[model samples]
Structures are given as C-alpha cells and as structure tokens.
Target: MAANAPFTPPLALASLSGEADADWARAGAAYAGAAFLGGIALDADSRAAARELVARDRSEFLPDEPITFIDRELAALGDVPIQPAFNVRSATVEPVAEAARVCRDRDTLLEINAHCRQDELCAVGCGETLLRDRERLATYVERAAETGVTVGAKVRAEVPGVDLPVLARDLEAAGAAFVHVDAMDSEPVIADVADATDLFVIANNGVRDTETVREYVEYGADAVSVGRPSDNPTVLERVRAAVDREFGLEATR
Candidate 1:
C-alpha cells in the first residue's frame, strides 16, 4: 500500500450506479480498503443526465438535496472501519466543491466522476466528456481540493485521443490525492498512469481472483477495485487475501 493513501489494505469496492450505498459499504467493509458510494448526480446537469439513465431502466442516483444526501449516507455507515468515499457526477465545479466540503466533514474521499461513458451523461458534459475536457476537469479537482478533503477522480482508460498519463499528471498538479482508473479492457494502461504520476492508482475492471489482483499489482497499480462482483463475499474474500499477500510483498521491497 502507498503510505499516503488512506485505503489500508489497498483494495476498493468500486461504486455501482445507485447500488453502492451505506449498507453496501458495510457489507463489503471487511474486504475493501475503501468503499466508493454513489455515482451520485450532484448538480442540475448531472441530475438531468441521471434522470435520462433512469428513463432507460438503468440505475442512477438522482437524490434531492445532493449534499445532505451525501452527509446522511456517510453518517449511516456508523463505525464501519472502511474508508468512505463518494464517486460523484457533476458538469460544473461548485457542486464538486460542495461535495468535497461534505466529505471533509466526514473525513471521506470525494472522487469526481469522469469515467462513466453513458451517452446521456456524456451529452450533458458529466461523464466521459469530462475526461476529454482536461482543463474543466482539473478546475473541478482544484476547487474540491480547496476544501481540504481527500480528492480524486474516476477516469476511464482507452478513450481515443485522451492521454491518461498526461491527464493524471494534470490532476496531480491540481491537488488530487488519487486516481481511480476504470481500465476497460486496457489493463496495461494502469502501468502507464502509475508511471506517469504520483497519484495513488486504484485499478478497476474484472477484478475477481488472485491472478487478477497479482496482475494489477505487478503492473504498478497501488491498489485494485472490484466492480460487478463487489457484492459477492466469496470474490471479495478471495481478492482481499490476495491483496494481503501481494501488497505485503510490495511493502517488503
């Protein structure tokens, strides 16, 4: 584990759209070093995008009073030792700042969402579009960092024309503490970003077993995040055991 990253065992439960709430975090608490709650819609544009997703029968968080919702959910996790983090969606900077303030009060991580590739979110400038708009994303990070909370960004890998290493470096310059990468079929890019920036890299995508865990570890990822199978204790336990063994090796060297 990276000494500066708060994720203890260096494993995270990646946020499932609308499913990764307080109870979900509590359930995975024993396995994950961090539980990312929500791909919550934080502003008008994101809320609109979320509603569009919901219209298509997809799970999307469209909470009324977004900041209060964050506070309430964090409070509900009462005494779970897992680090609480929110993966939030917004098309502008103010909501990111507001969400960061709530995270600061809770001592949780606030991750700006630039990884969601849903067309509705992209059309609204809330998801993968943010990854393409580097300056705007950096501004969001800068504002969130101002609140003195741990700030990070959830970014996608393999997006054409987007240099993730450069974006990671830009985010680091803007005061991000970590980068949660959704390595959509391009696992080696985790190494690229890890080599390019000091940001604690949490690699996501198809993480289920020791082989997967060891692969990310060998690729220079500081941690790995479980996405679809995060709810399965069998998988979490398997991955957690692997993390202890693999990351322990890193600690030794």
Candidate 2:
C-alpha cells in the first residue's frame, strides 16, 4: 500500500485557532493531493526522552502515545493517507514499540526510521549508527512483529558494496514487514534492489518531484513516501499534481 504524500504545514495545532487550522490543512492537503503526507516522524531521541518523561508523570504506567500529530493530520484529511515516519532507532525500540502498540490500538502503523545520520543523532547511537548494530535492529523488528500490526524499517541507501539491498534483506530477514529505502543517493544502482523483492520495498528522500518517482520505480521500490514536497505547503499542491502526473493517481482537479 502507498503512504501519505508529504504535507507538513509547519503549523502546530496548539498554536492555531481551530478555524485557521481547518482552513490551512484543507488548502494544503487538498493541494498536496493524493500523494503521501510527509511529516516530522517523531525524532527517535526525542521519543526516548518523551517516554521517560511520560513514564514519570503517570502514577499508573500507560503506553506512550506520541502520535498526536498523526492523529491530528488524519482527522484533518478524513480519507487521505498520512503515514507515520521518524528517525527511530534501536535504543528507542521499547518506547517506540509501546507507542506503536498505542497506534495499533487505533489501527495506525509505526514507521521505524534508520536513515537519519545527523551529527547530534549519530552522537547519541541512534539512526545510522544503529545500522552497525544488526542484532539490535533485528531484535526491534522481531519484537514489533509480535504486535501483529506491522512495523516499517526506513533505511538510507548506504551499506557500501551491497548497498541498500543488503540492508533491506537484513531487515526482511529480521521480520520487518517492509524495508524503506531513502532515495537520497543520486547514483542509485537499481540492481541493488532485487534482494528487496522478497519483502515490501518503500522509497523516500530526495523525492521532491515527479521525475524522482520514475527514478524510484526504476530502482525497484514497491511503493514510495513523498516527503518535502507534500510536507511544505508552498509546494503541497505542486506535489499532488506531480503524483497524479507521475504515478498516475487520479486527481480531483
């Protein structure tokens, strides 16, 4: 199945009037169209911290439900796709799993991010660094698989010789329902994606336009996640048009 197109309006619900938000999200999502919605995908490190704080505040322990934004977006769009994404890591798996459980209770899927390698993130042993910890990554998927709602592994196109394919295979072997590849690599080697066919393959990153979707298809992505274009309101409608143009999704206009 396809994910939501990117459509991050940069407007926090708490900071807006209900009327203003309804208007903005409607205009933005409608413009972003049928493409997948791009969102902040909670920061993995932030989730760990948020979980700890949430745990402390509760006299009786309850699972963390940091999916406030996802819920908000879904409510705004009604039937449009709004996928949950994040630079989640092995370290954050437990809290992430707990959050995913909460999402599953509501029929939402939790996307596990393994692509971000920001300086602050790498320093914390999250994101790409977790890639080096294969065992940890496997444990995460196998554990989440027990929840029966399916968890996604979002990995960047890296891993040297074998490239993203090997990573996707590793994730699939680990029980991940889908292995997500970030199309950030310009020199994408389509041959490297064959190993992913056994499992669901999703593409994202650097997909700022329609032509990029063609490239992602050429590279063998089963489905793709549109990020920047769908998320940025300035180009949300532009992206929706692009998805209709490129992927051939029916557009209302």
Candidate 3:
C-alpha cells in the first residue's frame, strides 16, 4: 500500500477479545505504530464479558497503550477502521449491532464477517450458512447501518446457492458501505459483482507484496486487507512500507 493511497481498513486483529488471550500478545510488534489494529473471533457473549473484564488500565487480554499506539496512527494512516468478527442470529441477539454501536461511538469502521466456515457454525446455520438466508442477511445489514455506523461485510468466494454478485447487491441495498471479498486458498479470482454494482470492494487472502496488491486494485478492489502473515512481525513492517509508499504516490498526485 502506497502512503498516498487511500487508507485501507484494519480487517484483522492479532488477538481476539475472548478466543485466545494469548493472541493479544501477538499485537505489539514493530508495525504497531498506526492503522486501526485489532483482532477478531469475539462472540456476543464474549464482548460483554470482555468489557466487564476491562482492567484498571483499560486493557483486557491486551494492553491499552499498544492499542492506543495503533489508534493514534489511525488519523495518520487514514480511516481507522476495525471489523469485529460477527455472525448474526436473531435481532434480539443483535450481537452484530452491538459491535457496530461500539465502532461508531469509538469512531471505528464496523464490519460484519460472513465468511466463517467452521463446522460448528455451519451445523448451527451461521457464518456462510447465513448467506443462504438472504432476507435475514439483508435485515442484518440494515440493522448494522441503522446504528449510524459505516457498514461492511466479509464474504467468501463461494457459497452453496448464493451468487456472490447478487449478495453484493443485496448487501448494498441493505445499506452496506463496503463489501469484503475473501479470496482464500489461492482460489481463482472471479469478477462478477453486478449485484453490489458500485460498492467499495476490498479483496483479502494470499496478499503480501506490491504486485498482488496492484492486481486486486486492477480487479476493481478499492483496497486489500493483509493478515495472519503479519504475525511474523516482519510482515507488519512490510505492510507499513507498502501502505506508506503507495499512499505517498497518491499524495504526490
């Protein structure tokens, strides 16, 4: 990512609020300076619990200072966005909505993640299974936006009967501001988003170098997300350099 390139969203966090407290330890690295750094895999129950567990220093499973380090750079890095991994079930459950509320009040971008494929989730009809329930998904999208938060959805390349392009459109109609397309497993990238029509798209998966980033942009992605690989710590530096260099070019223009 070039420094001048518009800021990309922080799509993944090193540590989830509840999944693995150890993951939070993965956050403080050389690349912790800026961007909306965050982790994922927090369920509704866990978020509430995590809030209750907030240490006196405001760190829970993670440190406030390091979190602050990333938040501080949000302005410098552009759009300090954070996506809380969510899987919606009932309006009453409203976990996704709760997460969005936090993001908006905190000035973070709230994204609904619909790409999980865990056997447990699928068996219970969540994650990708939700994609099959377009109407419900639409309602979920609407609910998130109504909270005054910028809405986004992360989706996988293929889902049983759902059409990706149509899903994109459905999401937009439901009030999504952005759509995250997961191109995991080195899957062949497909270009078919008539449904989303004109929503901002961010392609994730198998991304590391400048060329891969440019490829996604060429495919009409507004930006790309870098994750997991950054666990090496050195990879975080790569993202910093990539984002700075690209955005620098945009600045020159």
Clashes of each: 0, 17, 18
lDDT of each: 0.90, 0.49, 0.52
User: Could you arrange the candidates by TM-score from highest to lowest?
Assistant: 1, 3, 2
What TM-score would every model get versus the actual structure?
0.96, 0.65, 0.65
lDDT tens digits, residue span 1-253, model 3: 1222223332233222233222322352334321223333245443343344453333333333323433333333333222322222222227567656655665655556566565444554455766787787777789889999777676788566878888888988888877767876533443465224677666677667666666665565656665556456566556545644543443531
Q: Model 3, residue 11: what's the lDDT? A: 25
Preferred candidate (TM-score higher): 1 or 2: 1
Model 3 regions lying over 4 Å from their true place: 1-93, 185-190, 194-196, 239-253
Give a tens-digit lDDT track for model 1, residues 1-63: 344876777899999998999999999998888999998998888898899889999987777
Q: Which has the greatest TM-score?
A: 1
Candidate 2 matches the true fold with a TM-score of 0.65
lDDT of 2 by residue, 1-253 (tens): 2243222221111101112222344444445322222222245564453345345552111124435654554455555433333223335567556645654564544556555565444565666766676767777777776787566666665555435666666776766666666656642643366444466566666555567657666666555555534336655545445555655555434
After TM-score superposition, the amount by which residue 166's alpha carbon in candidate 1 deviates from its true location, in angstroms, is: 0.4
Displacement of the residue 231 alpha carbon in candidate 2, Å = 3.3
Check candidate 1 and list the clashing pairs. none
